[model samples]
Target: MLTHFERSLVEALRPLPDHRLTAIVEVARLSPPERREVFDKFGNAGYPILYQEHFANLRDIGPWLFCSGKYTSLQGQYNFHHGLSKATGDTPISWLTSALEPSRLARHLGEAATASGPDGSTHLLRFYNEQAFPILHSRQDLPGIDHLLVPIHSWWLRDAELDRDDGEKGWRRYEGKDRADCCGVPPIHLDQACWDALTGDGSSQRLADLLGSLPGAPAIESYYPNWLAQVRSLLAKGRRLGLKQQADLDEFVLFLSLHANPLRGSAKLEAAFNAAFKDAVDGNQPLAQALKQRLPPRLLTSQSNV
Candidate 1:
């Protein structure tokens, strides 16, 4: 089934009469048959953005570029974009219009498949992955990354974390700046700024501040000297369970604070709370409000426990 981003991508990629057409399809997560269909339709001439030079044998699983000429009608849209994003939990194929030939474009992108890290370590940069692309785009002065798409006439990428023009929560777009001729790779490295955006490098300091800022941070006050780590562990669990918002995360911190190490101190209560948490997130209701049935009223209102 088509996702919410599929139509928006198709509409956005529809180029002007003079514009070019090409898109990146991630085939690694796709089933074997799905991968075959793409190759069969496009042939072996398709360019891969990630390559063996940087990715080694795993390059086969990377994204492929194809000319999407017949993307006018809905069926044509299906033909060009059709099921291209079938791979589960992967970013959708991104669109780019470049005046350069396919080979030159491929060469330019392949250069970015790898990056150097501090202490002389080399790491693969998933530059083409729209999911990670936002991280790279979030900051300025990111070595080669800031202008990686300079050669392309126009580049459009999708990010699921952002708000869309439509009322619904779906995809967001980031257009490339510095549209100049490709000047080869600029030694894209895991710089300090890039690392922070990529991995939340200074998260401990931020989390500590958050713990102090919100009264609901820890379900209980800590006698433990390593309270930050304890709260960190609690927040980690909450994140895995879909608690992304600051308020929801703080409330979850408060809830799990009382649950103890085994979580709720019993399997049965844990199960009950799990169901309630899921319901609250899915229904867009306040988490603490929903937990009223699952948790005792006195406990919810009590002072932070030690």
Candidate 2:
């Protein structure tokens, strides 16, 4: 069944001029037959975001933009948008609408396919993924991001998952405005902020997944944003106090949440958390042991049982 979001989006784009609206889709999501129809057999139907000259190996699975006119046959807007939900498993989508010639828009995204981290590590950046694009669209930590957004008058993405937020999820339409011009080459550079939001030592989705999968972790259905924010906040606090190892950080987030936020609680638990952070970092004591040692068993038991 077509989702309310997809139906509404098709209506929104059906009136646009030829080449003005494009469906940003990942090739990996396309079935073999779908790939052949949209790409190999249908010339001018879509343009890939990864250039063959630079990313021949990745081109097959990279993101591609399917223009409206030829593929849809209904004016110049996409009528074939249902394929999107099929490919992305009905998750939110990233859309591109621009007056800049289709090829130019495709080239800009092709150039943005990779990124350079602040620490000097370089890797392919999937800037077009539905989950990642919303974060990319809002973050201004990198110049390359500006370059990518320059030609786009409107960028469409969603911040929340499809099933939970308001019926159609959180549809965010961003206008590219303010600050430096969007220019430059491939491999966008990233600072700490971008890295943290994008992939901070597996501290983004990976960390959330780790915690959310635990036997006692709260279900994300009703409190996705709160749960993520709480997890990140606790992880940051732990880092400040000296926790570094993955295991320690994970434990710290859990321990803090179990205490219903250690830093925000009574001065007693705060003191225990401080000692626990220090213990996890330098001393051989595990965070749980250190915290339990400092606090009474009744206190620990009450909170953990909650």
**Could you tell me the TM-score of candidate 1?**
0.54
- Which sections of candidate 1 miss by over 4 Å? 1-15, 52-56, 69-79, 83-91, 153-158, 161-169, 178-180, 200-306
Q: lDDT of candidate 1 vs native? A: 0.57
Task: Estimate the TM-score of every prediction.
Answer: 0.54, 0.58
Write candidate 1's Cα lDDT for 195-291 as tens digits.
5434443453354455455554433233121334334544545554566555565567666654545554678767767877887678667676666
Best by TM-score: 2
On residues 1-306, what C-alpha lDDT tens digit does candidate 2 reach at each position? Answer: 646655555565556444266667777866676666666433456778888587888776777776654544444244455544444554335776666666667776788888888788887888876445655655544567766777776676654423443455655567764212344354588666556655644565565665566575557665455346445545555554566676677666666555554457688777776776677789677666776678776444322342
